[model samples]
Target: MNSRLPATPETLAEQAADWIVRLSADDPGERQQAEAGYRAWKQADPRHAAAAAHLESLLGRLDDIRSRGTQGPARQAIHSARPRRPPPRLATALALAAALLLPGWIALQSAPADILFADLQTGSGEWIARTLADGSQLSLNSNSAVDLEFDAKTRTVDLLRGEILVDVARDSSRPFVVSTAHGNIRALGTRFLVSRQDDATVLSMIESRVEVRIDGQEQAVVVEAGQSLRFGPGSENSLAAIDGEMLETAWQQHQLVVRDRPLAAVLDQLARHRPGLIRYDRSAIAKLHVSAVLPLNDTDRSLQLLANNFPELRIRTLTPYLVIVDHEKNR
Candidate 1:
């Protein structure tokens, strides 16, 4: 049976950071509301309260460090020993800046190095389509990257990260293949979509068929048109039916057509189009369902539509690079 567990420690720490950011807002009304919301969140679970306290203690230590660094003896000793130290107020400002920006900074830095050097790469919120020398069409999703290797024997696409839609040109002599960390998807016919996730590679066959071969596996699984499969190194998911039109809309029309899917799934797609970090409490929004045809190119408008549709959800764009989504109950 499926069951939900308490929020993980990592999630709790993120929530604590969210509270700190919210409570530090400049507007008095916003700060007051954030404080009330934080109190309720802290009271919801002992873990939540402890996490908040621990973060507060860390901030306190930063203040202590700033004080000590600027004191008479330390300041004089440092000045005598070397060049002048930064002003106390400047040091305090820098400390505050680091505390405010560290979470987003860490998240930004977490992107894979392979993406930077990929033969073809798209930035956040950018999408590109290209026709290869073989006359095959390829489209990359936002924040996606791939390295292409074309030779006399084979046409290969190394999907370093994110998703790609390929319309393969018929080449009897050469086979078209998409490779991920877990497996290789060899196109049997015309079109297909391959997405690389943390754990598995998702194959959505659009026009024809594809053969998925997991690493170290002898046999290959055939996915026909209108079918989807998720496979990793060790296991293969049962083939499931997919909406071909929906997959086409994603690449051709640049829109997300959702039907009774989890809110987290929608947010995952939005995160690709959005720059910076999209942070949320998974446990809070896990049960919420979303059904909408949202524009992929305009994520801000899509987010606004979501907010209008779900009053229970509070979506805040904390910074250009940081978005926070949380449930009203948590507040």
Candidate 2:
């Protein structure tokens, strides 16, 4: 018996899988109805991103069930699961500046560092990318920041918060390195992504191999093309295999793909990409799972799109600092 959830597989696929389950109802007519409404809502405005994200999340989880043949396991069982908490104030700040303030970015720009080939950051509803001096690429996840120091000795970056994807151009002398709150990630002629989750560090290897040494104890994770792992501060790591096509790397092409992730996890991603925070009463909807591929540029439109698709969900704008998600919308 899978004790993690209360719903049966059929129940999950039918009525109770999520805040967007109605989009997959018994009647084909009803399914198309929901989808049509969702499409129109997505087209209505730019900020409808939160809505699209939620729907995408639902569809992604459904696909996972189709492929993996099970409902969502506990988030903790997965190697990439993270705790749900208030958006870091820093992330919220970044969210506001990166999207709406891009025209102002040139004002903040300084001479590019020699070793630090590129530096990119985004605010809510914003995304940014940069070409490294070495012909590599660095894509900054929403609400992410990096202070880079790179040279022949090593490629070093400080992840103040959020996540960064580093695509390394092969170089033997200039080894690529990333430092996060948890530990240091060193690449052996590799490409990888590093993220900060609270005090822990999540590492995903997209190519070759990388080594994570914590407190001088070297551990070779040797992530393959689609493997992911999370090493908490002073703890062992949980390994998970990933499909790169569904990751934020896809965001480079104006896409956001998700997998069998919890509602809280999806909400955090929204918070990172948009101004303000999209929070839920976790006590009210903790068991739901989400997956999606909404555009990364507009979160408000996404939220509107989500509300239209899941008529059962009630979204209340409490204030600029917070938005609440109700499991069912008021009729």
Candidate 3:
């Protein structure tokens, strides 16, 4: 059996980093193995390709740094002596931010350096669908993960990161519950979507009903179809009625249907499907609103559509991994 386990994005990124170091070696055998391993990994997951592409871009920048020939004595010593050394965190961070296209991301601080665990995750521009053993279905958006445990008493899935769409199968003996670091969502024979934001979790119901319980809370707030709730670590709960049909189910079809959503918000959503950063002059265009059906499958095309709609909007690409949007005069 292939002992190679399913690669999470973090592990894959590390492997990509290692391969970057190894591929630079002059030894033919090592270079061949590194190349082979990289090809296999890239074939294993679409996300791996994004990781590899990013490493390649970073390597180009390193070459640029070397070509500049402007190194201090200390830096030169480190570079000449440590030929096989891994790239610095700053370089990796820069490359990763570019690869993820973080809009207006300044540096490593904006990178998700702390997130370490994800049982299942998608790449920057990938989506996946899985059928659980119990016949329930789950689909993960790009850059998302979930830890699942199914047993006699419960079928629990911890949304370690990102967003998930769950279609729960009815099993009276085992209650299906989905959780994030912020709170838990008990699915009551429902089809629903759960997204983990920086400081809050957003839950939207598509069918049937579900109960929301914040961590360490007793009273469960029931959310039915056509309803959405945003909760944080504390007991602060904000619930609203929404048309889940357009916003919730549209992603399954690779579409985002929004009504008068701000440009920043739309870019944020679009960033999930792309690798690297999609940065804009937020201060200048934060209030610019858009209403359209943006395609999730081809994000670059979607960006083009957005630009075409707004004559004042200008899109600039520093590298394939870095995109900037701003007014033409600000270019």
Measured by lDDT, the strongest candidate is 1
> Candidate 2's C-alpha lDDT?
0.57
- Candidate 2 lDDT over 106-221, as tens digits, reads 32364235213435556655556788777777778676778778776877777776777888777788877788767777775667777787647878777777877654455555
lDDT over C-alpha atoms for residue 52 of model 2: 43
Off by over 4 Å in 2: 1-120, 214-218, 233-236, 246-249, 304-312, 317-322, 328-331
Count backbone overlaps in model 2.
34
**Per-candidate TM-score against the hidden true structure:** 0.69, 0.56, 0.64
Per-candidate total of colliding backbone pairs: 0, 34, 13
lDDT of 3 by residue, 231-250 (tens): 88653587788888877658
Whole-model Cα lDDT per candidate?
0.74, 0.57, 0.71
The superposed Cα distance between candidate 3 and the true structure at residue 49, in angstroms, equals: 32
Model 3 worst lDDT window (10 residues): 65-74
Which segments of candidate 3 are over 4 A away from where they belong? 1-117, 216-218, 233-236, 328-331
Ranking by TM-score: 1, 3, 2
Better of 1 and 2 by lDDT: 1
Residue 264 miss distance in model 1 (angstroms): 2.0
TM-score of decoy 1: 0.69
Alpha-carbon error at 88 in model 1, in Å? Answer: 14
